[model samples]
Target chain A: MNLPCIVTALPAESRPFFEHFKLQGRELNGLQLYSCERCLLLQTGVGKLAAASKMAALLQECPDITGVVNIGIAGADAPIGTQLVAGCVEDAGSGKRWFPHLPPLRALPDLKSVVVQTHDKPETQYKNGIAFDMEAAGIFSAARGKLDSSSVQCIKVVSDNHSSLVSAIDKSQVFNWMASCIPVVDIMIDLMADPIRDQVRQVDEFTESAAQKVHFTVTQLHQLHRMTTQHLTLCSSLPTLYGSDAKSILQRLKDELAATPLSYTNPMVKDA
Target chain B: MDTIYIEEQISEHPRTLAILKRYPKARLVSIDRYNEVFNNASQNFRKQKQNPALILAKKEGERVLPTPDQYHIGGQHNYYFSHMLNCIYDCRYCFLQGMYRSANYVVFVNYEDFFADIETITAQHKKPSWYFSGYDCDSLALEPITQFVEQCLDAFSEIPQAWLELRTKSTQIRPLLNREAIDNCVVAFSLSPEEIVQAEEHKTASLEKRINALQQLQAHGWKIGLRFDPLIQASEFERLYGRMFEQVLSAIDIEAVHSVSLGPFRLPRDFHKKMIKLYPDSKLLSAQLEYNGTHVSYPESTEKAMIDWCEATLLSRISSEQYFPCVSS
Candidate 1:
């Protein structure tokens, strides 16, 4: 099963996932491009707009990327440290709300469904509810119209109380804390890989079938000729069974012969 | 000349009708006419395409003239005056969209009636009165045609106690630059972070362009005001707003500024519901919101947090006296 290419807005947020996927290469830009046996990881920047742009660039760079999982920290109304899997990302600025599909997280035991309100700042804890951090909203907004909703997920760990968390932690500590959430990242990556691979297989089968229908080999053409001969023999017998019906059957036999797959060996053959 | 399209001619109740009757010379075109005007490419806003009826018919409103929530303007007795009906900019959260049916610009060209009413209101109140423009539409957005602000400034300059505030997101300051800055008038600009402006405020001037205009206005000695109204929720709001405030303060002379007002995402309940219906897919409108009486504002705690944070952050640079929380009264 091919796992999704996991992208994080913050390098610290992507650390655990990046560490899990062994680095296979580096880009000319000097950013390390890592690839595990099943997963791919790229660092997106902070905030909704920045994160969204990065995710888009990543998708363009890797069109084969079937699924995108945006992982990071969020502020919640629940207990400060509780983890949440965002079901929706609401842009507080534009009042646009997007619902994401996370089948893997849904299957988990006691996984909480949350609506992450993306704000310009870390909201101080209000009675309304927990608000998630910056990049998720941008990531979702950018991805919503671009990526299939079924293939995008935002999994976040509660990093702080809205008010105190911003003040208590230094920049480095926030990065370290994000780096430690690797186990959760691995499980989400593994969960999504199977479905993506299955989708690829289905697409491959469809492509092959479409290609075969438009192009025929020598063997297929020969087989088609044998079938036509049998069909003609049956048409020759139809007149004895029903007089007028034989005429219609003969017309159908001619149409079928015209529609038969042509051999590629013919000079007039067209590419499918 | 931009053709005015009127979708419907609703005869407002007697009181409202009386106000319209005062402007007997003002033309009333059918609503279909507006659709035709908007359908033209040259007449449309640069942002998003226009939708909904452009003009809204309101019968006599006792508060047709709404009192500007004073606290919002740093204790100024602010009264918002709308000369036109709708805004050219299609900001996603604008109340005018929800409050009115039409998207066409309705120019109540009977500048005489509006000025007469303002004269009466100012005479009744002896205090220094600040009359705000662009409450329902951008004051200078369509100034090329309307010339409403220019007329109002001319009329209000005669009244020593009357102050006109042309609150807008437009860099159309040519009207103001053409004339002397009315001592009583403060040309305020509604500013949002660059991100919000690009993503949500369709057709509004860019923050950089707006700041440049503001700097020019300040250099010319025009009284300036900064409005951070309807702040959006985002992960980097503080950094964005803080940076925005810092940038404005640094670019312009702070002392020449009139006042600064900060508000959160808030809408009147009816207006909010109407806006939501207008934009069912709008992420800003659909977010969970609690009603604070008739006002549909963010939850109290969220509102408080946002306001308090803004106040604290703004106070660090400007004095508390310079800041106002245009709270619902």
Candidate 2:
């Protein structure tokens, strides 16, 4: 199965994109459908924290998501009307930075390697020398930790500048700005998503048969016993997100399955 | 259960002597003094030889010391401590094969001396210190046999400022659960994707099992850490990691997690060479990697990309303060 390439956007930034991709007249949760290409793009609300949480939720819901891209209007260092694909995201509060997995910017020399910094207020970008964004950092951070780095891409069009023009930019301007760059967004999405989609398909093919095969030895079973115990130690360190009953059921399954000696007749008893 | 025999030696090293004093009850099996059983045939797991593991014991004035790799765990503090050698698990890429002359485990029964020396050094330094276990052997792999973590936890608990980081791929948490959680102790588990764990990290717990164990400990109020060091670059790494992260987050509560550290695959140049020699056919060790000074690591671009991805993902789920990148100096 091909993992989805999730896109995070606000109500304004999402409307036009959803309209552009709308296929039959059906809409799901304010998100319109494109061709059933096995990609899931989500409108993860606005702001860094919300975007981060939404991205996490998306990843949890769709473990097969091949890649992630955060598409929005960014306040670039260049002219207010300029278009640029952000190559990295920097957190202003923390010196930590994230380099998005876009195609190498070698061909686009005019495009600035924009750093998208996140803050509580839009005014925080005055001190930093780049674009201001509410969600890129959160998306980048979430994608980076949950997925491989090469699978995250951030494409932002310059909607406003660090100048007083930033405050003048309203919700309508953000939508118009994102709408104008629909073509560039399409290009960026293809560039970032195509390779990852191919890779995910390959992984699915490989793991499918391997997942079906079950081969474990008695010695391996003994080792699995020790491994399960150690796994219990590692899990015990984390807080409980699920119910204790679920945890116990999973543990019991692991114990029983891991303890079962691997015989040719028992196809279920196999190596992980 | 193959056993490799060893000859005995008496050393005057204070730490070695001190350890021997604690293990007065341990039997000392001896071979010829001149025929140093340092590298037995069965013990050598070098790539060229496929032999059974070895088991060795010695009689000394106070300690039974095992030969340990000098700098096994790198990054925070340079430390070398080994209560035992060799793990119960037979990971294909493990350095224990090349670094050790034998695959047999050598458990130093002396605990008091190890603690004494640790206390002495800890007292000397005012800065918060870190003592790493699971270098020569997994700190908790053989918990049922030796109950080593129990003793070490007791010793580390006494020192207020000193920190003890028990690194392991094992899921043995019974001993940890039995004791009171220590403030200065951090129980860090080495994690990999389910695919990597199944293929390369042979004899290790499943990813789900490990996560469950981590969750249990966090619920019990233990400060737990996630170590995604030595991340293997596999096909569809993003999907693998994405699923892994989702699985972890859904199964684990983010608030209780103390810290998460991510590092790409790394190995000392010498250790890499030795490991390659020990496992010439190992796909993991044979992967294309560049040598950065004395260590073999992923290419700069790849490492940066992987680390960047992991850092971002972790920050989204947890606070930035909780994420640590194990960068080499």
Candidate 3:
């Protein structure tokens, strides 16, 4: 679940990534998926509609993927080659808006933070400081129901600016820019992984295997999960249980905890 | 906070202007409404809690609401109002983590509206009406920045029948000490064992600091109250709580105390589920809990035993008339 999925609209934007990660590729129902041990990349084609459809399909295929990152080139008024992480993304066609929970940016000093606006057509007129892209909003919309806002993010490199029109840009230049920005992308992925790592699983492999051996009703299954979670957190280990069913196992766990009188508190101060 | 979100409608508000002046380096973003960020789905509450931002917006609609059935000190009619949405302190057992989607603090800048609502409600009642201020957020934690308690004291000074209780775990009492003590205002401090404070109440003042602040307020002629609600369970419950109570009671004059209340730790069913998912490793949440259909709390027998012990210990020090046991709703 800590593995972050990357979405790119064109192969030019993803070529350097696939080469850098040494990703192996496959075609799943006409969609391209490139993956490595650490990450997954999806080539979502060129527009909002196509990106949305393809990303939605990828999520359905991989439901456990917790993080989605849309990395590609964008047109902005700033200088070309300037990299930025989106603070807010809006769809120009529908006037819908979304704000991503920002990861701490102090550590990533090189990446500029900016607002992004997604458009249906190439933009000749650019707003001051806003990045214009074709795929961020689509990736966000498709992943909206499946992931948390913080887990879904967009990081864009400015390939075309006000002086240079997007139509004149070629794939080779896009690959060069993306290749140079790979380090920043790696940093972003690592930063995003920190929060996901903090999320602990209530049911570990041992607990899941134990439950399978017992005949637990849905309610009993939930109770067993809680009991085992408590046992792991407070007691530090799950002792041998001699119960025939879920009810008896749950009672034994409860009784063991009761005798101990739960009172362990981690001394670490995690609040800011 | 590194970022501050301001609603366009309240961009020019005087309070908002003053606050922005404090953090000139923070990145400011403009929005049409606070909910656009505060209510956004799929926000990781724990992640945002690490670096929470400040959202200043004008609160519209009903600003004052009735308090829960058991949330009262000594009033026939009781109500609670929140000028702020989230708290500065991160207590692991807090229900706020379950209640909110995003961890960003939302401060409603329309204090006059809340005061007007309080005045209106007080006029409708025959006797004095009680108003609780810290149910949703700490009344004094961010006092210097919000300046809310100062404004609230001024407003409550006008409506004598409206009793205002400023419950807090923060040691920010400079504002209260700077002004004359008001009889109608009770500065209530939520107390817990030092062990719990170190483990669970992450950013709050230590037990010793809270006692010092409470005693300072009492000496200034302010009527102080003690709140031990959501009494956390521990292996050495009697020794820890008994010592904490002794430390607090010995420091302050009992005659100046307004009231004392105690209640068990509990949360609505949905909130409990959400919190567990957020902090699966949390020992406080992982403790054996009794899940009735609608809420979760310590097992009934354990809850009863803890409450009975604490109540007896508290009643021994204070008069029965001064003690109020908050019933589970």
Candidate 4:
């Protein structure tokens, strides 16, 4: 997976996030960009078209995106400053929608879950029981294909609501709410980042290095993977397992696996 | 407080009507189907878990069916079903957490249908069939609102050939205590060391409260079973568990105890991946577990030691006939 990209609709939305993270180099199109070791942050000016355009460009540059995080102020039927994770994001213009399947990451303690409606223009009327935003649908549409929907997350801090008490809302306060939520958004990105994928990479590296010493056919390699089954122990104990050289460990495990009486019903198998 | 999502099909259901009445302030959202919202791809489980919504839907499929062979609790035809999808208590080691994509509770409001399905299954076999509740969710934690335990007891009373096991970690035993206990039903309490319960079983009743609930139920003529299932492994696990048994056995009536079951903490390889990423900081999930075929768990030696210690501790209080070791016995 590529480094995660945090996309915001406004400069204020991106300002806090951009400041919080240390980025290395950045590329600019219409929107400003900042990137670091394995992540990128972009300010997708405002509205749906800008969001889609900037997202498309970001994906083009980094094809293997871990996930996309959309953070901005939104209008909802909740208290102002309340943070929400988008459960279902809908494009108000075409009625097209996307639902990002999120596995349990167990982060974002105080934020609520809400269905977000992405409007092309500023939404004044929040009659429906959903939060209103300007960019999630566009971001989701582009990111869903590149990554799992569960990895694609959107963090919205409520700036206004249908029954908002204040006649005039403070702009700086809106920016501040989004700014204060940078930590939560970062945690969400980290939570959504696949840990298993990282473990798989370690496994792949160990397996590849081990295979380089001995010539194993495709069938033998498949059998080895089947025997190991990506167990966590094998991943952590890779260094110890392949002592001195890869050939000995490879030959030993392979011999052991071949000798094991395979059974369908029994889950108890000898770990390599 | 969280929002409540309702399937349009069951908006008029009696249980749905009763739940809405109980939680009137909860924001209500109507969806065409439960999956439309429940299965949404963009939802964050961690965020939703903070304020999990309540989904009321209709059960259309087979509501009662046999459980996996490994999940058998001494029955020839062991079957299980859920009136709910997710549980109220957020146990870190619970299989439900890994099984479902969503943490939001989905209660199928069709209780009568579940019972009717059970009737069909029981009639097919003359031998007593075991029906396990709380496999997908807890049987009595939300009893005050769901009333699932009460409803299931009513149904089990009629079917003498049916044995209902209401497994839970809840301290809610007033309903069972107030009523005449049925011979066919067993109110099983999931037991773990106080330290383990405190660490992994989030939002569940404390060990002391659960022990109280157990004693209360046993005194009221309700058959009780202790489930040390999904037993977690640690450095001093045996010492902690042996002490726990002494405290538990000393408090409750050992002769009245019906059965004790011990199981190891294990999860599907895929689910283990999902859970580890979900709670990376969790010591229980982060423990260097080995993948055994399709499932991941502590190494075989560690698993064996835990069961042996726990079985010895339990056997000291009760007879071998009264105890069942899931993996070993």
Best by DockQ: 3
Greater-lDDT candidate between 2 and 4: 4
Q: What would the TM-scores of all predictions be?
A: 0.48, 0.48, 0.93, 0.72
Stronger candidate by TM-score (1 vs 4): 4
lDDT by residue (A120-212, candidate 3, tens digit) is: 887667676589999888988999878887778888888888788887789898999889878877866775664424324435565677877
DockQ metric, candidate 4 = 0.09
lDDT of 3 at A134: 90
**Candidate 4 lDDT by residue in tens digits, B178-279:** 799999998889987777777778899977889999988988899999898888776667656776787788899888888888899888888877776566
Candidate 3 Cα errors over 4 Å, as ranges: A27-30, A109-112, A168-173, A194-204, A264-272
lDDT of 2 at A167: 61
User: For model 1, what is the alpha-carbon lDDT of residue B86?
Assistant: 76
Count of residue pairs whose backbone atoms collide, per candidate: 35, 41, 2, 8
Q: Which candidate achieves the best lDDT against the true structure?
A: 3
**Candidates' C-alpha lDDT:** 0.62, 0.60, 0.85, 0.75
lDDT for A24 in candidate 3 is 90
Displacement of residue B142 (Cα, Å) in model 1 is 0.6
DockQ of each: 0.01, 0.01, 0.41, 0.09
Question: What is candidate 4's lDDT per residue for A1-272, written digit by digit as tens?
Answer: 35788888876676676667876445555445788765688777888887887788777777767778888888887878888777668889888766654424344546666788998777877754588888888887777766655667787888887667334567678668877897787676676555546655665676676578666667666534433432333233433343444346555665553333211121331111
lDDT of 3 by residue, B1-329 (tens): 67788999999999999999998766677789999999987788898898788999999988889988888887999999999999999999999999999899999998999999999999999999999999889999988889999999999999999999999999999999999998899999999988888889999999889999998999998999999977998887887788889999989998669999998999998999999878877889888787877999888888999999999999889998899899664
